[model samples]
Target: MNQNGSEQKHYIDQYLREDRMPHIWCPGCGLGSILHCFLSSLIKSGIDMDKVVVVSGIGCTGRAAGYVKLDSFHTTHGRAIPFATGLKIANPELQVVVFSGDGDLIAIGGNHLIHAARRNIDMTVICVNNFNYGMTGGQLGPTTPLGARTQTSPIGNYERPFSLPYLAAASGAVYVARWTSMHVRRLEQTITEALLKRGFRFIEVIAPCPTTYGRRNRQPTGLDQMRYYRENSIIRHGADPKDVDIDLNGKIIVGKFIDIERPTYSDLLDEVMQRAFGTELPKDDTSKEEATVVGSAPK
Candidate 1:
């Protein structure tokens, strides 16, 4: 509320709930840091808060929708995309963003994820990948590295994890980038790009769940996790996704892997409608007498 009969624009503080100040996340959880970076990016982008809609799925990272004061929708587990899709189609002018956890996006909603990318829908998808399903007590997820230990895999995971960024790029996402919480500046830039891009844009932020995955994997604290990112992560533009791999107890690659322009689903839909209605039908110029003489008498 303001004197000019318009809602005053305060910083993100106005959007946050002070009562929810002490968030429910565990100590050293990277979700808070990622949320901070995202809000910072939104402020830097200068988009009108009212025009931005944040949609989220059910997970620790999905709590982002609750914290942000912007118009938000908290959908069922692994269904953020379809919900956001409807919002975007209904109000194409609004900026739609989807915040999801690694497991939510890659495990249960994996088919929808790829199809959205393939359709080139106009939305930004920010996937916080902490390697395991932190909200469910550290179960193995699609992004968990091979041989990593989780509550469900105390004997070390044997299945290969999905390379999220590469999968998005290969699935036709116009903008695909991978950044860890350590690279806040680059992460912000990538997110800004994704928001501004007109097609499906995917960003994978490698966050740390110190309470579950980190501590169990011997990286006890957030600082230890940051050190791991600093020591093992690579920083370079256009790094090949094939070369980027996280070996068990080995180096982890992080960087902006892909950025390309592509026609969005909305753009293609408009084209289709224009083609269907733009042309006129052939006209009938013959008179009634000519038709009767040609033996095509009227009923």
Candidate 2:
């Protein structure tokens, strides 16, 4: 609880891992800004850290699980959602959260992502999409824009990237928002709202991977990436999903895209159990006989 009567209010220092003083992210990396917004939101929400379970996959952003001093799980690549789903089902009281990169969430875990969203699981997923895979090296990801220069795409990337926010909204995510590291306050507020929401929520943070993606693409510094965000980014709330599109050299759309209410997975599961099992299954009640072999007589 906070000193004020409000439930949301805490010192950011309370949640940080001081031992890991300096993060390994590059100087221009937008990951730090994302982390800051997350921490601030957690503090503002006044949610108990012990009740919050942060699950992450393998990537620069995935390392966030280790840095946040909470009930964290550093899971395998693209498996964070499954792990979180199990956790949420087992202990519905825990607030399940997922933090991962674009490739981790959309590429390797694409199926799981859609299924989870479709199920309307009660959890929040924070996707830090820096366009490319930064940890392994500068490689094009599902969210990487076309014509972007990466290690694998020396000439230019021709493949189109995924519209993560639009996809999530269309997939039935109850709450969906898109923001960059530049809008720290708004990002934090959006995260706070997502955390408080009931069904599956998706927040895509369009961060910058200056060390790998930036260097390869010639935007070498974090400031350069920030400038790109400032100049080319457009701020609009509740924009129509059909109107949202990102060109190789066009303005970036960032804002709250969707919010809707529906029956969550947990709620639906309980309803099914009640209807199928009639409150609870009887213990040691296997009275029905098993099937015998077609040619052999039952003994």
Candidate 3:
């Protein structure tokens, strides 16, 4: 409850919507920490705040757009990526970030995610993966581990969970990483790196949903899940994404999986436009060609 203190001056409040205090996330939930790391990264990224756009879809994490004091948008379920895509395409100088939940991003927005990666759009996606839908009660989600119990699967989960890092890498993401919310320092570092990287950057954060997934799965508290992460996580940088799936009570592989440069969507489009028109594009558009590509480099 300490406010207006001298030490609190550097408090991570510059990017927050102060009027929106008392966030709606459940107690011990990791969304708050994720948001904190994100804000911290934004501060460290050194990107022009005016050129940064925060986008989110419907979920617990989607509320991030509403709380951040920046150019933010809370879009429809699973559509934050596409919306941010348009923003980037319209203004290539903008640093668009899609911040939302795993269910909204992987389950509902899976198609958009793949296409965006395939196209190598210049954007950062921070997926807060709690293994279930945290906002609308604890229902099973795409990232829920096999054999884990959820409201939709009380006895046990039968479907295999998707390894998001693998999906993003395979989909052609220039940079892909995963970390538990407990790894706040590392998470902040990754986010800052992703923000500065061009092309599709995907960061999957395994956060705790103490009220739902944890209670049903025996953790019962956020600290227990965090402890599980601290003990079980293996930091294997550049690990094979295909072998990084999250299994029930299995070791979690966490690190930067892939980072390779290629032509981004904007880079390709600008080339086409210039050749077709036989004239240089606007000054703002010219800079995009020299940055943020995901495909083969131009000769």
Once superposed on the true structure, which residue ranges of model 1 sit more than 4 Å away at CA? 1-11, 279-299
**Which stretches in model 3 have alpha-carbon errors above 4 Å?**
1-10, 280-299
How do the residues 256-286 of candidate 2 rate in per-residue lDDT, one tens digit apiece?
A: 9888899999899878776887745531131
Estimate the TM-score of every prediction: 0.88, 0.88, 0.91
Ranking by lDDT: 3, 2, 1
Flag regions of model 2 displaced more than 4 Å.
1-11, 279-299
- After superposition on all CA atoms, what RMSD does each candidate show versus the true structure? 9.4, 7.9, 6.5
Q: Which candidate number maximizes TM-score?
A: 3
- Please report the candidate that would top lDDT against the real structure: 3
Per-candidate clashes come to 0, 1, 8
In terms of TM-score, how similar is model 2 to the real structure?
A: 0.88
* Positional deviation of residue 97's Cα in model 3 after best superposition, in angstroms: 0.5
What's the candidate order when arranged by decreasing TM-score? 3, 2, 1
State the C-alpha lDDT per candidate. Answer: 0.83, 0.85, 0.91
Per-residue lDDT of 1-299 in model 1, one digit per residue for the tens?
A: 53335565446666665445557888877788778778888888888888999999999988888888789988998999999998887567889999989888899889889999999999999999999989889898887888888998998999988888788988998888888888888888888777777889899998888888988898989789988988888776788776776666688777778888888888887677667755342112222345566775544
Task: Give the Å error, residue 22, model 3.
Answer: 1.0
Task: Give lDDT tens digits, candidate 3, residues 201-235.
Answer: 99999999989999899999999999999999999
